[model samples]
Target: MKIELAENYGFCFGVKRAIKIAEDNQNAATYGPLIHNSKEIARLEKDFKVGLTDDYKIFKAGDKAIVRTHGIQKQELQELKDKGVNVVDATCPYVTKPQEIAQEMSEKGYSVVIFGDDEHPEIKGVKSYATHGALVVTSPEELEGVKLHEKIALIAQTTRKVEDYMKVANYLIPRYKEVRVFNTICNATFENQDAVRKLSKKADIMLIIGGKNSSNTKQLFKISQENCQNSYHIEDEKDLDFSWFDNKNLCGISAGASTPDWIIQNVIDNIKSKIS
Candidate 1:
């Protein structure tokens, strides 16, 4: 069997930027996982001595704290700064756009509507920027029967599928007098999703790589599964099941924005060895 990789898989600009920031601040602790990939985080900890802290209060005055790429709630960030922690913002520019939009739109008297999982860190951070509170929904169905203001402003999680975001926009545009829709989804997401959609159609087996908790990775897995029944989402080579490769003619591989090339290569190498 032959192995192939998606054209636009692994380590997006934001993840790369965050990694560099973490490397530069060796002794600093990130408030959350710097990125979704645990292996990469481990690599950072082992090599650079960067640490991860779930609680912001652990940092003392003058201690360095690197913000996660997903960002923290606006209040949390302010509190960190107020506590005199040397804060380094590593929030992805793409994620920051929605947070700014939510605040700006909300201040302008537009009801903010975020198309994303409310529980997601990015969404929680973005939603906090809305002065009057924002509505979070995963689908158009969730918006049903909910009362929205006459003027609405909509933004999406950076990693969410555009088609899903559109469904939410379409639902509001018809009902509201003025609906302002911002394309907060990043360019990397567009390219990655398109690449997976194309590759999965041709490969007999598909491996989507990234952290299990990664939203973008989950989206890639969903798209791959839609076209290839043999699609599997794996974090690394260890998760591979050789049984899935039986009689497979060609294996396609794709990784999420948060995934690093090293992990992807390891999975590929393992697959090649097993099938050989």
Candidate 2:
């Protein structure tokens, strides 16, 4: 069985940069885990005294706070700064664009509607950008029975699926008076998902490697499962079950934006070795 791998399925630019900064400033206490991957976070925590917390109480004196690539809420940022926290912002530039757009729309007296998971770190951060409070909706159904303003601005989470974003956008366009769409889905996310779609076509079984808690990883797993029923989402080699690979001919491997290449390679190597 020949294994196929996605060209654009691994750690993205945002994740790479964040990890590099964490390593360079090993002593600095990051406000959150630099990225979502537990493996990387574990490694960093071991070497660096990087502390992860949303609470402001832990920060004092010379302690520096590093923001994750997903970004942080405006109020949180301000509060940290006010507390004399030395902040090293690692927010991805692409993720910051939607926040700026939402802020502009809110300042112009338009109602901002963020189309993404509300509880997600990125969405929460984007909400802080709006001068007026922004509304977050995960899907069209969530907006049901709710009255929309005449002038509304729309933005998406950086890791959202493009098709899903369009579905929600089209659903609202007809109901709202004025709607502005800003495609904020990260380019790396789109490319990674696109690569998985391409690989799924040629492979018999698909393996999505990433942290199970990772939203981007879940999205990738869902995308792969849609195209191939034999797809499995696993964090590491230990999560792999031999039964899932029984009689499989070819396996395609892909990963999320936050997943490190070393982890992906380890999973792939383990799976290949199991092939009799």
Best by lDDT: 1
Instruction: Report the C-alpha lDDT of model 1 over 1-276, residue by residue, as the tens digit.
Output: 799999998988999999999999988899989999899999999999999989998999999999999989999999988999999999999888899999999999999999999999999999999999999999989888998889999999999999988999898998999999999998999999999999999999999999999999999999999999999999999999999988889999999988999998888788778787
At residue 42, candidate 1 shows an lDDT of 93
- lDDT (Cα atoms) of all candidates against the true structure: 0.93, 0.85
lDDT of 2 by residue, 61-159 (tens): 567889898888898888888888888888988888988998999999888989888888888889999997898988888878877678889899988
Scored by lDDT, model 2 comes in at 0.85
Worst 10 residues of 1 by lDDT: 267-276
Tell me how far the alpha carbon of residue 100 in candidate 1 is from the true structure, in angstroms, after superposition.
0.7
- Candidate 1 pairs with clashing backbones: none
Task: Provide the TM-score for each candidate, comma-separated.
Answer: 0.98, 0.95
lDDT of 2 at 225: 88
